[model samples]
Target: MASDIIIVGQGICGSLLSWSLLQKGISVKVYDIDADHSATAAASGIINPITGKRFVKSWMVDELFPAADKTYSEISQAIGVHFYEKLPIYKLLESVKEQNDLSARATETGYEQYFTNTDVQYLDKGKVKNEFGSFVINGGGKMDTQLFINSYRTFLKNKGILIEEPFTYEQALVSKSKVIFCNGYKAAQTGFFRDLTWQIVKGEYLLVRIKDFYADRIISGDTTISPTSEKDIYYAGATYQWHYETEAPTEQYKNEIIESLNKMLHVPFEVVYHGAGIRPSAKYRRPFIGFHPEYKHVGIFNGMGTKGISLSPYFAEHFAEHIVNGKELLPEVDVKNILIKS
Candidate 1:
């Protein structure tokens, strides 16, 4: 079938890019196998404005968060499926130093949006531990990644643009339409865009069910625990491993998550699922966007890393504008500038 663009991979990148393109009246044919190891499938889809050990604001949060909210709402309305939600984050302070740091950050001029509640928030003593105290962070939420992806895939299928198969470099080279690779870490493996530098990371997580322990908001401490649509089930512990022998889940990481859960929760829980995925990150920590230098017809929209939920929608719209209306790509994320160093 003829299309304006052919997209490889149906992860968050591919899905959002296609959505953006479709909004611009562009036709797209997507290629993907929906592999079990998809990073989007394993992601908890937490969009936390305040992150890191220092408890500072995430990069580009002000711009990215609004774009995410708009794009997700648009897609949800179009598909008639509700997957995006704005939930507060309950950041549990681990030490006195962390408490002091948060206190200082709350006094900062621009941090008031996220750090509104400086008072220590307490939870039920039997349900979860809050000895060191915790604070509520606004301007953050969770995306039901699986639901969004599934609903959008169905949307594409109805339009006859969804091709459930793997697309390789050989096919990409000869495709009539411009081909864009939205595949995750496997893009590094293919070596098609060899000029780009990558810092691939493997992340693992668990699905646990705690009886009668319901969390209305995301609980963050040693690990993040976010509620799912299913009652009593929550996502926990996405460990970031810079070095790993394989992309598969490990017992060590699973146990580590269990240990953290034990420390954070006073109630007993049952682990129902374990999963992992490799995240393709750029060395400088920005998405790799734009066509390849040599192969003008080939393009990429990957390397979103841990911030895919926050980054993908806004950047997908940006990338789509560049393709449709001759808009200049962002200087920081454009691939031309990124490859010059390599």
Candidate 2:
């Protein structure tokens, strides 16, 4: 069947891209192997507004956050599934400096909505490591990333627009459809987007069984512990390994995560599941979006890195507009930046 577009890799990026295209009344034939170790599958899908060592705001959070909320809400309603979670991100104060940084931001006018300096106790029971206290990020949320993508996949299948297989560039045009690579870190192996400086790394997390633990909001310490789609099973993780030999789970990092969790959490917990997946993080920490220089019909939409959950929906819509209307992508993320150096 000749379709308007053929998207590769049905991760968050691909799924959002397909949805955006489909919403615009475009036909999209998706290709995905549905790997068990995909990043989207392993992700807790927490959409944090502020992050990093200094606890600064995430890139484009002001704009992207609201768009994501709207997109997820509309999609959830359309599919008859509840995947988006609107909750606070309680950042545990680890040190005096970290405490001061947050304090300074709370007084600032622009940061008022996202940061609250009011003395609040989210997890201060000595069981979850918050001796210094924590602040609330008002508009933080999470999405059941895997659940949303999987459900959307079934929706596409019913529409006769899905191919449950890996796509290779060799099969393009022979099928007469524009192919956009929405595959995550796997795109690093393909030569088409080799100009992109990928800082790919495998991230590890755990699905743990903890009794009577309240998961009203996400908790952060050395690692982030967010609620999973399932009740009572929180997603605890993630550790980054630059020199990992396999994307498969490792016992060393699993124990490492447990150690970190123990510091934040004094409770004894059992590891119900361990998951590891590679992120397509960019060297400059920007997404690689837009078309190939030589292959006009081939485009790359990867390199979302750690912020894929928050960033993908906004960019997916932008990318769709670009494809459908020949609109301009911001110079920073434009694929022409890669071609300029090439």
Q: Pick by lDDT: which candidate is best?
A: 1
lDDT string, candidate 2, 1-342, tens digits:
455798898888888898999989898888899744578887878888878776678888898988898888888888888988898888888767767778887777777778665554457474676877787877789887778877887877888988988887677635466889888887788657866788997899899988777678888887788887677898898888888887789999999999888888877788999889898998888899998877778888889988888999899999999989888998889887777785
Model 1 poorest 10 in a row by lDDT: 189-198
Candidate 1's residue-wise lDDT over 132-201, tens digit each? 7888899999998888888888999999999999998998888778999999888888756755888898
Best by TM-score: 1
Q: Show model 2 residue runs off by greater than 4 Å.
A: 1-3, 120-122, 173-175
Task: For model 2, state the Cα shift of residue 120 in Å.
Answer: 5.1
What lDDT score goes with residue 5 in model 1? 96
